[model samples]
Target: MIDAINRKIIAALQQNARISYAELGKKVHLSAPAVAERIRKLESAGIITGYSVKVDLDKLGYPILAMVQCKVYRAKEREFKALLLSYDEVIECINVTGEQAFLVKLAVESLSQLDAILEAFIDLSDTNTMMILSTPVDRALPETFIK
Candidate 1:
């Protein structure tokens, strides 16, 4: 179970993952070695999964953000999953229990790219496309319930 100190460390990491152990120790009021040991323990327990960099998709030449919702027929679940896995544009695919079977997040350069992706999906399964108008807020919520 995470204690108060571990929670502080996790919060700090979430804010700035590149913060050195010495700096984190200063923030959390622990020695550098102690903070290191705590972080190691968190990793061993699977509480701290990994770190990643947040990139600007548009600046990176990915000017399109589309959420493709698919209402796949029950008969083609395996095939659909395999097709999605093969598509590099698919950032994430989630299965939902409502009218839509899966919601896919795709990043691309233009409508032509989206059209190509949609054509592939339409040939494989029934899908509905919804272009993202704007992302007002998109940020990770803290894993504050770890304790």
Candidate 2:
């Protein structure tokens, strides 16, 4: 089980992953080497998977944000899954419970590009697309602690 200090380390990482081990030590009340060792152990145990940078897709010229629900035919699902995986515009895709087999999040430049991407899946799956106007709650990982 994770101790209290490890939880604090995780909280500190969530705030800013770019922080140096020496800087992180100050926040968690530990020495630089101690912090580094803890981080290594966390990674080895798979408690700390990896680090990432949060980016603004809109600022990067992808103005169109869409959530596409795809109800796929089981017989042709292999091709459908592979096709979606190949598209750069399709940023996120996950198997879902309700009416749809997969929920795909897309970031694209225009409606034409979105249409073209969807056309390829038409034969294998029935897709419902919803364009995102504004994201009041942008993408964030599930937070277990904050400190």
Candidate 3:
């Protein structure tokens, strides 16, 4: 049950969630209090989650970004999962099919740092590494068509 008003409010928020209630009210043709009420409802309904800023890892001194495909050897699944969770550099880890058991995307400061990180995986059978050159397209969810 997506109401037209809610859709418009969502679109506006998606554009800039930090917009003032008065400004949002003007755009949505409602009072500031009305806008606040609508936003509260949206938040309470779990439609609007917490906001986050997208960070540039390279500029922050983490210049190395690589997708390391790993094949866990002679391992129990519990230990493997714990090991993955213990590392801070590992932004994303997944168990997959094909030649590798897991693929890990890492953000590291340097090759030495990456090597240090990979040292933890000494027990792993083999790992295929591919360094990311450039991000051609980092797409966000489509909100323009919601209205």
Q: TM-score of predicted model 3?
A: 0.73
lDDT of each: 0.88, 0.87, 0.80
- Give the TM-score ranking, best first: 1, 2, 3
**What lDDT tens digits, residue by residue, belong to model 1 across residues 1-147?**
588899999988988899999999999999999999999999999989999898988999998899999987768788889999998889989998887879999999999989998998876578888888788997665656646
Q: Judged by lDDT, which candidate is best? A: 1
lDDT of 2 by residue, 14-112 (tens): 878999999999988999999999999999988899999988888999989999999998788789889988999988999988879799999999899
Better of 1 and 2 by lDDT: 1
After superposition, the stretches of candidate 3 with alpha carbons farther than 4 Å from their true spots are: 73-75, 94-101, 124-126, 144-147
The TM-score measured for candidate 1 stands at 0.92
Better of 2 and 3 by TM-score: 2
RMSD of each: 1.5, 2.1, 3.1
Instruction: Kindly report which residue stretches of model 1 are placed more than 4 angstroms away from their true locations once superposed.
Output: none
Q: For residue 137, what is the lDDT in candidate 2? A: 83
**Which candidate, 2 or 3, would have the higher lDDT against the true structure?**
2
Better candidate by lDDT, 1 or 3: 1
Provide the TM-score for each candidate, comma-separated: 0.92, 0.91, 0.73
